[model samples]
Target: MASSPFLNEVRTSIRVRGMSIRTEKTYIYWIRFFIRYNHCRHPTEMGAAEVVDFLGHLATERNVAVNTQRIALNALAYLYNQFLKQPLGDLES
Candidate 1:
């Protein structure tokens, strides 16, 4: 999956911005999870509504900790805002 062009682009974007390797890995992990959670739909094809659903799933279905959900939200924010150049604009968190 790391070899995929989209993931590679993500990696490149992270590195270009001087993000730590751990941050890179964490962001990639969450991004991949998000993609898989949405049945492999492209992030560019999704937006705030999808993000809201994923976060809701994390809280209600997966029962993740609040901080964990925040981390996932941060990863998606970076993916859209930093990598894809699309601001996610005031998500519910």
Candidate 2:
């Protein structure tokens, strides 16, 4: 995926909020993965359904562990809640 200033800005925002570097990296990874999984669509142009799809892929295809699924969910929540200011309600993750 192309490097995005938007994602960089998300990292900065996480840093500014006193998140650890590891947390920043994890969040960025999920954000990038999400965007790429959605054909590089901007997060602002997507929503909870896309998140469900990604997480579903992890479950049914990648067989990601439970904690891994949770981490992905958290990252998406941060993306929508903090970055886009659009909180996803009742997301199944």
Candidate 3:
């Protein structure tokens, strides 16, 4: 498969902000997982509903712990809120 400049851009953004290597890796991991979970579509095409489903899957089906779920939410928030600059409004309901 071809490379995704988008992921590279995300990585660059994280590094430019002086985030740790581990944090970058974790963020990238979740971002990638989110894309793959949604059938490899670009994140720009997704929105809050997609995010809600992913988080719900993590909580109900995957049975991830609370902190793990929070980490996933944080990763996605950074992707949307910080990198992509697309707000996922009222996601915490």
Candidate 4:
């Protein structure tokens, strides 16, 4: 079996866990943005620092709405906890 990429694994797991289609789409969207923002760097090579910067950019630079920002956070949380199977520890404000 082909091992899934981090993003794909996140999507599958989220769907399997019964997240709504809208939630899944939002999560996947942010995850894709995270990858592209980092120049398509694989999620395996990224850590919380990248996530923090991305989230900050979403909230401050892009001026995303609060719910949109929360979606980004949830996407990264799924990437760390489910896809990468790594503990993300505490997020810095």
* Top-TM-score structure, candidate number: 2
Q: After superposition, how far is residue 33 of candidate 1 from its true place, in Å?
A: 0.4
Which runs in model 4 stand beyond 4 Å of their true positions? 1-6
Q: Backbone collision count in every prediction?
A: 0, 0, 0, 0
TM-score of each: 0.93, 0.94, 0.93, 0.84
Model 4 weakest lDDT span, ten residues long = 1-10
Model 2: per-residue Cα lDDT at residue 68: 99
Q: Candidate 1 residues 11-60, lDDT tens each?
A: 89999999999999999999999999999999999999899999999999
lDDT of 4 by residue, 3-92 (tens): 337667677889899999898878888888899999998887988889989988988899999988887898889878877788678888
lDDT of 2 by residue, 1-93 (tens): 566899989988999999999999999999898999999999989898999999999999999999999999999999899878999987754
RMSD of each: 1.5, 1.8, 1.7, 3.6
Off by over 4 Å in 1: none
Worst 10 residues of 3 by lDDT: 1-10
lDDT of each: 0.92, 0.91, 0.93, 0.83
Runs of candidate 3 with Cα error greater than 4 angstroms are: 1-3
Instruction: Put down candidate 3 lDDT per residue, 16-40, tens digits, no spaces.
Output: 9999999998999899999999999
TM-score of 2: 0.94
Residue range with the least summed lDDT across 10 consecutive positions in model 1:
1-10
